[model samples]
Target: MSEGFEKCHNEYTLFTKTSKEGKILIVNLYVDDLIFTDNDEFMFLEFKNSMVRELDMNDMGRMRYFLGVEVLQRYDGIYISKIKYALEIL
Candidate 1:
């Protein structure tokens, strides 16, 4: 949470340490789950390790689904949708 990154007033938003060389890391917390992304791989790993050290939680690896939303990671970028939820509702 606020241990490593700067906490946003909006409750669950966190941003990595400011640095021109390091990519900014963004983290959003939803109850027990955390969704995080960074432009730099090293920065991401550093943040992840910090989280692990600060909080007792499992690293679920790459996010594929969360709260019924399907997360698809591609070379271009990430795509998120609730197609499965929509189908289920249908």
Candidate 2:
């Protein structure tokens, strides 16, 4: 995680790394779950692979839900909602 990654001063759970070309990779840790994304596909894969190799964690593929919030990733953009959470409470 030391490959130019720096901890966010205000957020201990957030880490960010920047490539020389200015591409950014972001990682967020919540409890035991980790979510990461990178602007560059090659770099993203490299980072993901590295993490998988070092940590005993499974890649659950794409994310659908997190912390009771639904996430929808579309070609156009990403969407999130709490409708499922609300329904469960009803």
What does the lDDT come to for candidate 1? 0.79
Per-residue error at 86 for model 1, in Å? Answer: 0.9
Q: Which ten residues in a row have the lowest lDDT in candidate 1?
A: 10-19
What does the lDDT read for residue 52 in candidate 2?
86
Measured with C-alpha atoms, the lDDT of residue 8 in candidate 2 is 97
Model 2 gets an lDDT of 0.91
- What lDDT does the true structure give each of the candidates? 0.79, 0.91
Q: Residue 58 of candidate 2: its Cα lDDT?
A: 91
On residues 20-78, what C-alpha lDDT tens digit does candidate 1 reach at each position? 77567777878777788888888778878987898997988899998899999988999
| RMSD vs true structure, all candidates | 2.4, 1.2
Which one wins on TM-score? Answer: 2
